[model samples]
Target: MSQTIVALDCMGGDNAPGEIIKGGIEALKENKDVFLKMVGRQEDVNRELEKYDYDKTRVEVVNATEVIETGEPPVVAIRTKKDSSLVKCMYMVKHGECDALVSAGSTGATLVGGHVIVGRIKGVERPPLAPLIPTEKGGALLIDCGANVDAKPSNLVQFAQMGSIYMENICKVKNPKVGLVNIGAEEEKGNNLAKETYQLLSNLEGINFIGNIEAREIPEGKADVVVCDAFVGNVILKMYEGVGGVLLKKVKGTLMTSLKTKIGALLIKKELKETMKTFQMDQYGGAPLLGLKGLVVKTHGNSKAIEVKNSIIQCISFKEMNINDKISKKLAVKKEN
Candidate 1:
């Protein structure tokens, strides 16, 4: 089996070098075919490495003197923070030194670095951040969740196309149904952007465009690939997270309010827990900025070790499945046809 090397941004997330290093070590221990290049301050990385026991050859430490904080301007940070761990990791992917990069850092920085450093694939108008969102029917890929806030009609058509490829290849959803996010099911009931995108997606070949889907249908899994501009997509994503959290809290509170309900909760605790686990963002890892030359995943800024580890493993699968090549071929075929 070919080895998949992933560059880890050690100082990017809320947990910093400690959780990042731990996750990298855990991924290395679990997958023998994976290698890691930990990038951060020398002393910090070395200190973390000493706590773990793994094959020394499978891991390499690279020194990066600067750390880009979440508050820094994304474009400026990427250009100015030459010695930052995130920038160095981006360069590694750009130069083919690493197969992918996983970060729990500033989302803006990750997105900007992906476009500026790694560059987009040929003929790709814009690369959107597509994340697998948990739904009733397993999951769906939400493209442009936060990448391009002001997307054009053509951009959304590409989002549907790229999202379909991702779902089919990575999530194993064949002939994934694509839906345009809109206010109503009727084709004429949206803003100019939605109406234009709906027409384009409906006419586009090689995608399973399923007409308009409202926000309410998203949780019900009305579409396997939900296509929308970043503005709408971001709103939907935030709503999902917020609603999920509130519902979970409400359930827990209601169960604990009465001894009878508490007993009932205990009886179904295992099953309930398992069902809830299916909806967690960590299980699906991070969102990938699709169309980049190399994979760039942005996990939650407050991500813990499990999210980090899963993101690393996610990178391995992306490379192994040859997602980028598949996307390139798909787009090329579209042009030819």
Candidate 2:
């Protein structure tokens, strides 16, 4: 069987080796073709592994001398912390030593290391961090979540193509609808960026260009791919998080307010938890810095083991889907214009 090797940055996320290590084992146990290379302090990794005696051959460890902190600048960490676990494992992906690199490290550092070390795919103008966000109808791919916040209309045009391909291929949304985010459904209702982007996207031939979608319509499944600058994308992502969190707390508080309600909560606790899973960003794993030469997934810094492991596996899906190549083809189409 071909090796689905994943180079894990063991020191990247909040849970570190503890949760990441356990999640890796679970992933390998469920899939025999999978292999993991845990990159971190060797002693610490091995000590954690001693607790579970699974298939030892499927897992290996590579020690790194330094660990990059979340607070450090991304460019500096990628350069100065060359021996850091995040950088080392990333290098492996760049050189094809591993199929993918998963890290819950600093976004800046990951972006810098990915571009400076691994590089971006040919014909990719600006690599966006595209993550799958679950919606009522499965999920939607939000590109340039934070990569190029201050993007140009041309950049947004490209994001529409990239996001379209991702939703079509990886997400399996055939002829996925594309919408440019605006203050309202009108084309002239937004700032210079949104208005110009709306015009550009309207003329773009590659995507299934749906009309503008307001932020209010996101969860209602108005469109599969919403193209915009990173600033707007980031704001939407944060707003979704804030709303989901507030709602969860409100429901819990309401349920615990009375004995009768508490009883109802107990009866529906499992269902509620399942419902929450659909909205949990962590459950969807980390966001992918799309358009790079190699796969680089940046998870939340506070991510646990499952999120880290799933992010690693998520790269496998990205590779399998040929997302980068699809984006490249779309870009080539745009270049002819």
lDDT of 1 at 212: 98
Candidate 2 local Cα displacement, residue 37, angstroms? 1.7
Give each model's whole-structure lDDT. 0.91, 0.82
Off by over 4 Å in 2: none
Error of 1 at 196 (Å): 0.7
Write down the lDDT that model 2 would get: 0.82
- How do the residues 1-337 of candidate 1 rate in per-residue lDDT, one tens digit apiece? 8999999999989998899889998889889988999999999999999998889999999999999999999999999999999999999999999999999989999999999999999878899998888888888899888668889998888888889888888888889999999999999989999999988887888899999999899989999999898988888889988988999999999999888999999999999999999987777788999998999999888888888888898888899889899888888787787
Please provide, for model 2 over 88-112, each residue's C-alpha lDDT reduced to its tens digit, 9 standing for 90 to 100.
9888988889888888877888888
Error of 1 at 205 (Å): 1.1
Candidate 2 has which clashing residue pairs, if any?
A: 74-109, 120-293
For every model shown, the clashing-pair count is 0, 2
- State residue 97's C-alpha deviation in candidate 1, in Å: 0.6
Worst 10 residues of 2 by lDDT: 308-317
**Model 1 CA deviation exceeding 4 Å by range:** 263-265
